[model samples]
Target: MLYLFQQILNGLHMSALYALLAFGYALTNGVVRRTNLAYGALFAFSGQTMILVAVFGWHVLWLTLPATVALGILAAFAYAALVGAILARSVFARLAIRTPNAIVVATHGVALMLMEIGRIASETRDFWLPPLLAWPVVFASQGDFRATLTVMQLINVGAILLVLISATIALERSRFGQRWRAVCDDPKAAAMCGVDVPAVFRHAVLAGGLAAALAGILTALHFGNVSFGTGLVFGLKILFVTAVGGYDSPPRAAAGAAIFGMAETLWSGYFPIEWRDAAVFLGLVALLVLRPGHEETRVAQP
Candidate 1:
């Protein structure tokens, strides 16, 4: 029972991160109808930059605790937003409409370039960060064991909930939501009706990128280290989540992520950890083979 409770808590935190990351992918795909593979790169970039800022504060800037933490967070968000905007405008916006294969190749190139940059910057090594909030809260009790929630995990849940709920409400009630629906349903008609199709697409990518960045930072903090290879793993997991969730709905993405996190966590706990990812990949492949056209039928709407 204690093990079950602990796994459930862990699953919830992991699920939140996966949901946010997958939602970012879904957001971009909704607008341009193309997957921005570079999203994982952006996720890694934000996390790496956050770590770099902290390192600079400690070694180079000689800053106090508060200053270091603030600077690191600010740097993370600023870099994520700026790079997201620039990439959306320069790369995704221009190529997403031109050729399907072109955008895929271009985004993959962008992802590789970012990964290489991370490698060089970190001197071909992994980067670690001290947890911003390491305190844990007791949640459950059993014979000689207690379940606790770390501050970071609680923050992860809060952040995901706040962002997802606010975004959903805003998309449902605001003028921007109407514009987004207009574009998603039919870009040509939306443009004819005075909707800025390109601008909508750009916004979608930027929004998705920022969400991915936040997820990356939280995930790195949870794991206590950030690696260059983590981005690709995140991208692949979120890809599976988006596919299973049905790209048309963010809520469905969250649901899929919850299932994924629970299954992955339970599997790792019960089996050899080395085979965890292989199991997930095989499961994803099986799911794809079983339901090849599930996503095609569920149309996107406001």
Candidate 2:
């Protein structure tokens, strides 16, 4: 029973992390109409950065929270402006004029380039980030049936909740949010009404990048380690959550993240860790098979 409880808590923590990444990915995809395979690289980059910073004996490790998020936002903005622009000018523009396959190939090519770059930069270092907090909360009591919660985990949950709430409020009440909604609703109409569609997209990409970077930092703090390939699985998981959750809704993405997190956690605990990928993939397959064409619904305004 205690083992079960521990597993459950672990699952919740994992789910929250995945939800954060999913939310970021969904936000960008919702606005840009393009999927970012490089999204996960932000996590890997932030984690690696955090680890390196910590190793330098800098007191700034304590400031990783905000710094990591800022890094994420900056990286996202740069990647979107640079890579996204190149795609827009070279491949996407050609595709718009000729064949849609150009867009697909271009985006995939960008993803490949990003992955290779990350691999080369990260190498095979098993980097570690010092824990953000000490002490773990015990949530259950039984013969070895204990569930422990870390301060970092709690912070992660709080951070995600805050992001979701803030995003919701901004979208519902702010002018920029309104403009974003308008752009999403009808880009042509929004542009006609003087909304800057490109600016809106840039902001969206920035938000997504920041979110991914934050998630990576938090994940590093939580797990105490980072690797170049870490973002690969994370990217896939975000894609899964976005697909399962209504891709347009942040709340739904969170929900899907929780579900996926819990499933992966529990399965990993009970079965071989190697099966984690297979389990997650199976779950995604089940969801898709059960709800074919569900994502076709129009995105709801905040």
Give lDDT: candidate 1, residue 291: 85
The true-structure Cα RMSD of candidate 2 reads: 4.6
Question: Mind giving the per-residue lDDT tens digits that candidate 2 earns over 78-175?
Answer: 54456444544454444533554344456556656665665575575575554568478888777755678887788887887788778778767988
User: CA shift at 22, candidate 1, in angstroms?
Assistant: 1.0
TM for candidate 2 is 0.80
Name the weakest run of 10 consecutive residues (lDDT summed) in model 1: 293-302
Off by over 4 Å in 2: 57-104, 143-145, 292-302
CA lDDT, every prediction? 0.78, 0.68
The per-residue C-alpha lDDT of model 1 at residue 100 equals: 53
Which tens-of-lDDT digit does each residue in 1-302 have in candidate 1?
88888888887888788888877777777776666688888888778877777778977899986687668778888988887787777776666555555777888888898788778878897767666688988898887798888998898899898998888887789888788777777777888888888778778778888898888778766775677767888887888778877777666776787789888988877889999999998998788789847543222211
The prediction achieving the highest TM-score against the true structure is: 1
User: Which pairs of residues have clashing backbones in candidate 2?
Assistant: 2-145
- Per-model TM-score, in order, reads 0.93, 0.80
Q: Cα-based RMSD of the predictions, in order?
A: 2.6, 4.6
